[model samples]
Target: MIRGEVYEYTIGNLRARIVVVSANPYNPQRATFAVILGADVPTPKSPSLVPLAAGDPTRGTIDMTRLRPLTRENLGARIGRLTRTTLVAVDDALRTYLGL
Candidate 1:
């Protein structure tokens, strides 16, 4: 999957929504694991959380603080993609959170 794509995955007994944050090329071709940020609702007030677009069906904040590497096999169906603006915001949050 490409960056900015959202997908569902089961972690233990909890099913969670995740957004792919890994860059392309490596993420699609080379990498065995892709980096993702869990999406959670009731958007909390945090500098690291990037809110999804208003029109998004899966409304939640991308928790930048908790970056998890998920294997391709673990990832489920494609939920939805982030809007251009939201993706940019996520990139900015990631930069700030990662100190990049």
Candidate 2:
């Protein structure tokens, strides 16, 4: 697995579009964590969505406010991928989230 790829993974009983925010994949024992998206429409740079595009729908919006820690047990099926541009924006958001 690679960073920036969006997937429809199931965490417990709920399923949502989550973006892989961690680095390095080969190891599948545990997932560092991910940003989860929901039916709630995200707004630009809000506590929820960062830079919401008027007509853009690529990956889960950069939700700096939330994340989920998953493992091989909770990791579910793959839904789709995110565009490179959006992924880059997400990377920026992540850096901001961590203040790194």
Candidate 3:
């Protein structure tokens, strides 16, 4: 599992942090909603997020860099779809990171 945090800075406010979790170590495509909390801090409600990293590559597949880009206005849905699609493409690029 891959675990991390995300921080967002507002114009006049301190930066906020959210916990990131993934199912696979090598793939961000397999991540799911684990938790959201203060930066560099863990909370009681924090879910055990896991990494969704891919395991291996497949034969006769195109590179991930050649694939089309995905965009979404909804944060939740966009993340869900991105994770699913990323894991599916792990065979082509080994793993994909959205850097969300």
Which candidate leads the pack in TM-score?
1
Q: How do the residues 1-100 of candidate 1 rate in per-residue lDDT, one tens digit apiece?
A: 7778888877877677887777877676543222344353355677788777776547767788878776676778888787888878878887888799
Give the residue spans of candidate 2 off by over 4 A: 25-30, 42-44, 51-60
Model 1 pairs in collision = none
Error of 2 at 89 (Å): 0.8
Task: Provide the global lDDT of candidate 1 against the true structure.
Answer: 0.71
Instruction: Kindly list the per-residue Cα lDDT of model 3 for residues 1-100, writing each as its tens digit.
Output: 1333222212224322222333455334543332223224332321122223342121122222322211112122112122444334443333333422
Question: For model 1, what is the error of residue 92's alpha carbon versus the real structure, in angstroms, after optimal superposition?
Answer: 0.6
The candidates, ranked best first by lDDT, are 1, 2, 3
In candidate 1, what residue range of length 10 has the lowest lDDT sum? 31-40
Q: How much lDDT does each candidate structure score? A: 0.71, 0.59, 0.28
Which of the two, 1 or 2, has more lDDT?
1
Q: Which model, 1 or 3, shows the larger lDDT?
A: 1
TM-score of 3: 0.22
RMSD of 2: 3.4
As for TM-score, the candidate ahead, 2 or 3, is 2
